[model samples]
Target: MLPPFRPGTHLVFFALLLTLPSQALAVIDRDALDTAVVDAGELSRTHTLLVAVEGETVIDRGWRGHATDETANIKSLSKTLISALVGLAIERDIIEGVDQPVVELLGDRVPSDIDPQVNDITVGHLLSMQSGLQRTSGSNYAGWVASPNWVEDALTRPMVGEPGERMRYSTGNSHLLSAALTEASGRSTLALMRDWLGEPLGITIPAWTRDPQGIYFGGNEMGLTPQALLRIAELYRQQGKHDGEQLLTAEWIERSWAPRTRSVFNQDLYGYGWFRTELDDTTVHYGWGYGGQLLFVVPERNMTIVMTSDPTPPSNGSAYLEQVKAVVERMIAATVP
Candidate 1:
């Protein structure tokens, strides 16, 4: 059985927190770095790790039984993927805008028995995780599905705060976005992603779990290869273009990174569907998930790092992100003209 988690069913994280060098560390020796991470505690038992420099694969390693094309469930990294699709839907006029009141969008789904402030929430609020809805992930998830319509059940939640008043990291918000996208486009999110990202980028979609309501589960599990995650990051880095064509609006990419929430920790910020941060002044936007699953896209340095893991506690994960950031820092130190 899976271990316990804190708020939001965090899926947990555990990374070897490294002490920063009194002096900057050296450059990218792909082989040396891979060996180092693999040697670090249980992180060494990680299923997969992929690193890319510019658009080229620099390091690729797998556990005893894995491969380049093999897709693994990315867990919550899919939230960021869902965020990009929301932008594309807006670009296509699939919906009026993210600010549209969600209750009107979903029709009868809002429980007739629930509070009316549910109607006041907007699509943007949902995407940014400011929805004021009860987090529907974790142990609450089972009770969620046991009911008839999971998506509707989530929307029925009363406003915990004025819309956009506070930051509450809830996966339910993204599932609502997926349902909204389905309603707006008249197609499933999976099909839309297949057409927009998978086919265009020559990528694959691994296994995905769906609710009885037909909405994709937002956080827990969505499969993807590390290379696929890198492509998704590369697409964002290139401002949502692929092979010379614009797949996502440049303004959306720019707007998506506009920090809307401040992190309790240093070196991080939250935008619409993206996370923003800097390491030594170089900007890195990334998606972090339970157990350290992530795609760290560093545009200024033209690097991307992908990590997937089994859930670990916060005491262990506290330095995990910083350690990954250190990898980029050391690699950046390696590059000098």
Candidate 2:
């Protein structure tokens, strides 16, 4: 005979069941991903490649003597983490909202005689790389880093266009967000990161670079182990929840995945911290870093993927990224119908 239901018993049962580790929603054709890695020769340059389906890691491997557990510089992928922190800050009331004016946040830090256009920039502008400030990336990168104060240098740059007008793709914009987070929360970005994400996701976040002002560098040079990267991607794939904990609001995830602009370099749609595109009939939201550090989330398939490459070599517009995409394509196709 079956046990009779009791008041709240079903709820308790469901809660207990939810604590069990997640299982794959669908099987992946492991051989396909394996063959793709070999055929593409990604092993030579790629340090690690990982794939997770339905919150369970199915494939974890490293190449060229690099261990999958080794922390690798994620480059511009740091932008994605910074963007996530921005969402958490808003949720925690650290800042008002994405519409909060940049100048309002930075009061006295505003550079002397800064272009008036800077006042109109918002947190959203920085998140989407549409701050209208001349980019501090590319050829401007060395000079920007050479400056004594990263935030002040970024603010002092002349506005090339009005805020929210176009995607400028600058590390300067991310650095400013990092600075804002520090000022608004009265905590180092690294501290907030550990408390907000690293603790929740059970991932280690080691300290990265900081500006001359001691603010953690926001958009560049952050490091994470490939396994940790997979967990982060899985967090987004699950709509900002992990093991029944809502780290980020589903609404914010939707907003982050929604395309607000387009990347000039690749023409891919840009959301808050993710790049969006449809590959092989499956939508992909991704974080890309220099030298081929990549994290991809395919929500429709309940899958997350990470690829780490040599951070020292140049990969901008290089064949390496294309090969990374090819690997993704293979993984996407491996999804069981």
Candidate 3:
């Protein structure tokens, strides 16, 4: 049996209450949470579920012989991590702000014959997947990764729409950001992540897949333990502070959560790498990865949740993702007064 959730044990929640007068912490029903965790185990695709309320871990469970500490491919949740790196880069003046033209950062890597509109795509457009490039995900993903030069190939892909015009949902946009970060910082994205996020958060960030150019695969194939992902969610829940230090600015968190585009598949609003939606009538922000890896933050409840699943199978339109959301909804319901 899980222990009962105590609301005021953590100073973080108390600090948040000072600014958010509209929200009151609720004592979570441990039994209900336990039931939710157990029910989550019944889902064949799910591997683990961790829920923290008011900065206190209330439930951590692993199913199908999987352990929460084992590293798993976070898939496109890597996009969210990349998004954080972009914020850190801008904060440190490694690159300019989001409005900075991506071609300026790419320099020689920008293909010579590419569309002129490529010059107009800003860092923000790539962060929000509005790069206007034909998608390198879905049916086109295999070909893009197999190409000789990822950065040049992605840049040369025909423009599908105007930059910042619509949400196109392409991994190519994120890969370009990875390349830009690599060129602008003069360091690999892995090194930047280790120095900027891993050290401060005290989490092990294992290396994941890289492209032909040895740049870390930007928006997908990164691996992280469930606990590590929870730490990230908590960082955002604390408004980019960790252990009393401002690891990422609160301003970046606001901008990251601000709705910049909407997902055509689910209609959830996309903000940078995060997704915005409502869960049980409470505003929720989340980072969703392929095959059900999820990180959810509920500011009103001072909660962060992580769920990891088998990455081999596709979860889109499978109703499996909805099942994962239902599990989170149960956890949210337990927090209601």
TM-scores of all predicted structures? 0.82, 0.91, 0.92
Which pairs clash inside model 3? none
Candidate 1 vs candidate 3: the lDDT winner is 3
Candidate 1 per-residue C-alpha lDDT over 1-337 given as tens digits, one digit per residue, 9 for 90 to 100:
3245456541222222122333222135444454555552235325667766655666677765765467776666788888888888787878778789877666655667767777778988887778877767655766776777878788776567878866677778888888877776778888888887888889987547888878777655788877788788888767777777888888988878888886554347888877887765777788877656778777665567776655444424436656665655554444321
Q: Tens-digit lDDT track for model 3 on 1-337?
A: 2245467532222222434556555566667777788888888788898888767787888988888899989999899999999999999998889999999998878888999988999999999999999999989999999999999999999999999888999999999999999999999999999999999999999888888889988999998999999999999999998877999999999999999999987788999999998988999999988888899999988889999988885565537777888888888877753
User: What is the number of backbone collisions in each predicted candidate, taken in the order shown?
Assistant: 3, 0, 0
Query: Rank order by lDDT, top first?
Result: 3, 2, 1
Instruction: Please give me the total number of clashing residue pairs in predicted model 3.
Output: 0
Worst 10 residues of 1 by lDDT: 10-19
lDDT of each: 0.70, 0.84, 0.88
lDDT of 2: 0.84
| Clash count, predicted structure 1 | 3
**Which regions in candidate 1 have their CA more than 4 angstroms from the true location?**
1-45, 263-267, 311-319
Which is better, 1 or 2, measured by lDDT? 2
Whose TM-score is greatest here? 3
